[model samples]
Target: MNIVDRIWNSSLGKKYLMALTGGALFVFLIGHLVGNLQVFGPPELINGYAHFLKSKPLLLWGARLGLLACVALHIASAVTLAQLNAAARPQPYATPGAYGASKASQYMLPTGIVIASFIVYHLAHFTALLPGVNGVGDFSKLTTTLHGETVPDVYAMMVLGLQVKWVCAFYLVAQALLFMHLSHGLAAMFQSLGFRDHVWWPRIECFAKAASIALLIGYSIIPVAICLKLVGSDYVERKKYDLKAANPQPAPAFVAAQGKEAK
Candidate 1:
């Protein structure tokens, strides 16, 4: 068999693939979290950022497709690994506790499935601009003023979307599950990538836990802030700019008179 085929069939190769894809997705999460946090800033700041992304269709769609591919590969590899492990041990463990698996590790698969489902719902809720799905729809027509400049009303969309109590509750629950998944996945990714030295394992695990907690807080703040009205309840009035107010166009009679006088 060719080296590629051999690697494709090997457990180690699958682990490495999972680690690489998970790492990439983790980086994307950090970027996504940072962008989402812009909701706390002036409306135009986040709205302008959203507009900027939408303006670049090629780059935006390319990134979206790439992310989707990563998610598919990550999930597939995880499921494959789980099946392999299960098939290797057909009998149930007499004492499951003997493995000493962390709770996060034990629930990883279910949490991952939940997280994946949440991702799809999230896309439909926000990215797809679906109506009545968390009150998001036609964001292009929505506008808000910030620093005297009019921009897309992303802040309002976020606030409105999460204002529904059930939506917020669901979001919080999903985020908690995500935190659990990340807490375990991060350390496992490192170990799979061969960072398993006894000297640094403790430190790696500590970093993983800290990073997961930070991410959880960062993600949770959006819904929590909206719920507490920290981000405001009333929608900001859309700034309507009148063309005539900005620059008065000369009347037809005035233009005709001017032309007659010139003639």
Candidate 2:
């Protein structure tokens, strides 16, 4: 059989795919956190960063599509491997914990489902610039000028978007779930690839947990701070700008171009 067929047919191959995709996701989490933490900097800092990313549609969209593929493959491998395991052991263990699976490991699937849902909501809330209960006028129109170029004001959007109590609550819950999922998945990633050993197993597990906690803290900070008003523009003073975001009429030149294109 070809490698592709063998991989699709074998449980071992599925495990490897899960590990590879999970690892890639782990790295992405780290990078994403780093980019997000730029919010703590001046407006120009993060504004420039976001502008740079938008300017390079190829790089931005490439990474996005790549991550989307990784998420899909990771979930598929996990589900298929789970089915194979269930088929192998039709009889249930009378006692829970009869298997050496960690409590976190036991929850990988459900948390994964929740996280997937959160990903969709996240994309809507931020990527699509949807206005929500946070009372932001229109997230898409939030903008600033840098080097004579107009760019989306990401820093302000984050603060206002997260200011809502329920939004903050949801974000915190998601981060907690992410911590649980990653803590177990990281160790499992190593063990699946045959990196787990008697001497190193404890260390591997420890590292996994530490990394998970760090990520949880990293991700949790933004929403919490924004909700508490530690970041972003002042609401009372920024009412004028809020109006601009809420009612952005298309420029005549842009409309004319669109009309020509449509014709």
Candidate 3:
């Protein structure tokens, strides 16, 4: 057998690769979402943030290589595991309803594959992957740049795309599928990477589900809001600071409670 076939045939090697790459991608997703969240503020805000990320050419290249490695490992492990799983089963269903499936069971792999495709498309559309797409914005031309850098208005693309009936519908389906993928993937990855104790398993599962949903909702909001034009440039600019207040004044109830307790 070829070296490639021999390595994939080993159970331990496959699982180890999957666990490592999966963990890397999970952390990257969280970081990516945090960076992307800046887009909700203003074009300048996110633009500058994006610029900062790409400022050092070497660092950007390093990040790209790391991401490419993660993607390669993820897909390789997924395909290998899928084949192994099929081989283990080896029997076709005699009847369509012969086996019952839970929502997570039915959707995880399919949704994960779909989300992977979405990520590829997103990178192509927004990043400097394709030719003729300038990197970020024309920062030099700006009168008052936020951070002396510029990021493309990725939000505008999302808004315009989702504004179309068909595209919006597509994203809704993809987003739902993505949530299912995350629900399973996040839990599975943590356990695979040795977070497997009974005591922590349930709580980790809960945390995974909550974090996945929160990220999904946070991303979904920008598109929905933009499509509706409920959030414009002015609102984004104003909300930047408004959204970051850590300890604003207490509510009336809290103030009244303090007053009465003190009295």
Best candidate (score: lDDT) = 2
Model 3 lDDT per residue over 1-263, tens place: 99766766787667667778877877787787787677667656665666677678898899789988988988888887887877987777776742665577566668778878877756664553341122222211122245453344444443333444554555666777877877877787777667779899999889879977987887677556665666554443433333224214444355446545743
lDDT for model 3: 0.63
| Sequence-dependent TM-score of model 3 | 0.71
lDDT of 2 at 209: 91
Model 2 per-residue lDDT tens digits across residues 1-263 = 99988987888888888899999999999999999999888878887988989999999999999999999998888788778877988888777754776778888998998898888888888897655433545666566789998777887777777887898899899999999999999999999899978999999999999999999999999999877878764742384455455346555355446435753
lDDT of each: 0.79, 0.82, 0.63
Which sections of candidate 2 miss by over 4 Å? 89-100, 132-135, 233-241, 244-263
Candidate 3: segments with Cα more than 4 A from true spot: 1-9, 93-101, 128-165, 233-263
Question: Which sequence of candidate numbers ranks them by lDDT, best first?
Answer: 2, 1, 3
TM-score to true structure, per model:
0.83, 0.87, 0.71
Tens-place lDDT digits, model 1, residues 1-263: 99867755889988888888899899999999999999888766788888778789999999999889989988988899899988987888676563778999899889999999999889977776555466433333445665586555777778777877888988999999999999999999999999889999999999899999999999999999987777846543221122123224454355446535743
Ranking by TM-score: 2, 1, 3
- Badly placed stretches (over 4 Å) of model 1 are 2-4, 135-141, 144-151, 236-263
